[model samples]
Target: MTLWNRLLLGLILLSSCWLGLAVTPSPVATKPNVIIIMADDLDSRQLSCYGGKNLKTTHIDALANEGLKFNHIYASEAMCVPTRASLFTGLYPVRHGSFQNHKPVYDTLKSVGHYLADLGYRVGLTGKDHSTKPKTVFPFEIVTGFEPNCVAPTDDYQLNDVRKFITRTNQPYCLFVMSINPHTPWTVGDTTEFDADKLILPANWIDTPVTRRQFVKYLAEVRRLDEQVGEITRLLKETGQDKNTIVVFLGEQGAQFPGAKWNLWDVGQKSSMVVKWPGTVKARTETDALVQYEDITPTLVDIAGGKPIAGLDGKSFLPVLLGKSSTARPYAYGIHNNIPEGNPYPIRSIRDTRYKLILNLTPDEEYYNRFMMNAKQKDRNSVWFSWIDQAPNDPNAKRITDRVVKRPAIEFYDTQKDPWELTNLATDPTHQNRIRQYRQKLETWMKQQGDAGAALDIVYAKKKE
Candidate 1:
């Protein structure tokens, strides 16, 4: 062979190597993945990790032990769809036009899917899909499994679709796993594990044989939910994605009890939120920072190395997560506009760490919701009837029944001292000054959110340009 021929062959090999290097993808292109697991109708206090005495939640407690557990996080609305919408869009229900349950947000609104997708992440949803309508607004790649009732009496909840989505994708992803557990018809899980006679009831709960029976069944479902959480986290760890992924578990809303589900009180709005980010967030930490469902989207966006978007009701709680900020917000607001589902009993509330003031806009009318009223009236267990039956005989039982149905114009409570919110301090002369200050705060907030007050009852219409 000639020397010139050998030189030419060598040059060809060097050029091929150069071309391969030029075409290779950069390591920076692989961003961190995010996984959000949301549970339905479970409150923070229902979990043993959050000081729950009634039941033990071993799996969720492990996550809390390994991540940051937030003490004062809340849902923007007490119902499902509205709170879910707020979490995705980083806007309050009224601002997002989904203040009512089963209502859709305005057509133009974009969600976390859009924001994360912009940064080259594949966004997908599994389990419950109760977000706003037009479908395009959320735009998540749908994954299936865990669609049955909370108390369906079957352990058929599968995560195959979600697992396949993760394994198939080489790119980073944002996966939302919604678990429809502890919602209603409480029939799933081992009811026998929780002895009705031995179960400890909440301070506000009326102690009756039927009430105890139903409460134990509800506790059983909560235990089942904790098992599901364990399964999801175990999968992430086994797949070697747990380290790079930020796993968030949220108690979507309060339990479906009489005073908790549809109201704007602490039990209704407070949620259990735990976040695990291997490197960025310090483990085994707890924060008392005030955060709402509206803040979730922005915080996730910031965690994914994205810039903050403008005109959002929620400010990112990234600082709180990173141990840089101790306080997230001074106050968290709540609104409940009951229509279509029940009577037009509009309520607005504002709460700081210690104080809370609730304004019942339609105080002249009785508060009514068909589902809740039916639960009391049509309950086969006669739990609610027992409360009403003993109302006249027992003053405490009477107070509980009256508080469930009746409403005054204004109600105030120092939640620090009155967590159950039994006593109304709005009429107390000693709290008159405090009441006036909170009233002004509530009104200012209403105006800022463009709330139409009682006018919300007369069918909400979009304002003209």
Candidate 2:
């Protein structure tokens, strides 16, 4: 057939397939590629598109401009292993048996790798294999490009393997391009670009020289993460998979700052997810529909023409992605077990769109994280000591330090008015009713997940090989 005649016939066939007249299973057309780029220890609120006053994340903002930005996505457990374990398995931390940092998911559990691969997709992960355990459970084609170590001093990476993986024509791909930027030792990106004195600090942080220096490093990595986003999306476009791929950018928990990583504060549990599904998800839009890391795998499964895996803690939020629903869940839950990272302090939280309730399972004990609060470390920037040093004169610094160590039996905050959750309204008589309801809901969820709360923290958890 002539070239023009063949092109016309191809267009007619595609039109008939869309109209359900002739539904032939075209592997690439039926199953869109899924590329997920996750940032390590990311404080997503620092991104300009997320109301950040820091440097404009031009690359990530471009994705938000071309796709949908999620406002209420959370990490559930706030720790690296627990959060990622929950994400890969679609189960809460306790249920998956990775309730503590560095802990492994249950051996018998199934991960997104198994689920997506079972559905005929080439599932793979490139970096940060914290959740890729028990190879029998997670059989991802190990791609190489990004650095996998979170605390590596240098984050030099090449995209040769990444380009090859996305360009393959045999099957649709679900690639997790996890970036270990902005993690501890924050030495990956360009700190020269940020003026430490002029940057906007978090509402709850104290302005200290050490803190500012470290923040410049952290924000630089955030910029690096955005650059990686730009590179990956550009690869997709060059390979002609941009229109047939769903690009998801995840700010994996929060940064490794004292009050952010191992705690239950909003800064710790809050995460970000931006989805770009060309011709499917609406562009230049935002959603307040609650979602968590646990919901990610289920949504990917749904998108790959598979049903929601029953018995999973997360449900598919594809409806929210497609703008078919305004809400996904009534509440987003958070869990924190501070054993491996700190003293035995367990926290459970539940938040709706407006209010957040926190239950400290061991309130009498002071909370402590050795790495974040260390005062004796000389080689690296121990910013926590500077906060303590300034606390004597600066009341805000004192409040911030005290806020990290001290605790209460119950803490509640109106997240709508106080996004940082600075004030504890648990004692307010007017909010008592709402607090009680959230408490009941949180307790029920804990029970459902078989979470022992403070008791689980007493055990010393170790990483699995």
Checking candidate 1 for backbone clashes, the offending pairs are none
Q: Best candidate per lDDT, number?
A: 2
Instruction: After the best TM-score superposition of candidate 1, give how far the Cα of residue 301 lies from its true spot, in angstroms.
Output: 1.2
Candidate with best TM-score: 2
Error of 1 at 14 (Å): 14
lDDT of 2 by residue, 1-465 (tens): 999999999999999979889666676447888999988889989998999998999999999999999999988988788888887889888888888888777798888998998898998899888878789877888999988888888888888999888777668899999888878888778889999999999998888888899999889889898998999988988878898899999998888887988877889899888999999999999999999888988998999889889999999999999999989999999888887777888899999878999999888889988787656664455788888889999888899899889889999999889999999999999998888889999999988988877888866635435
- Cα displacement (angstroms), candidate 1, residue 278, comes to 0.9
For each candidate, how many residue pairs have backbone atoms clashing (under 3 Å)? 0, 0
lDDT of 1 by residue, 1-465 (tens): 799999997887789898884434567645788889888899678799999988889989988888999988888779898999998899988889888876678878999989889878899888777783567789888887767344455646787877898888689999888887887777788887888888878887789888888898788888888999999999998899898988899998888777888888888988889998888788899998999999998987887788998888998999998899999998889889887658888888888778889989988888877776666457644666777778888999988888878889899998888988988888889989988988898899889999988887655555443
Q: Model 2, residue 176: displacement in angstroms?
A: 0.4
* Clash pairs detected, candidate 2: none
* Cα misplacement distance, residue 156 of candidate 1 (Å): 2.6
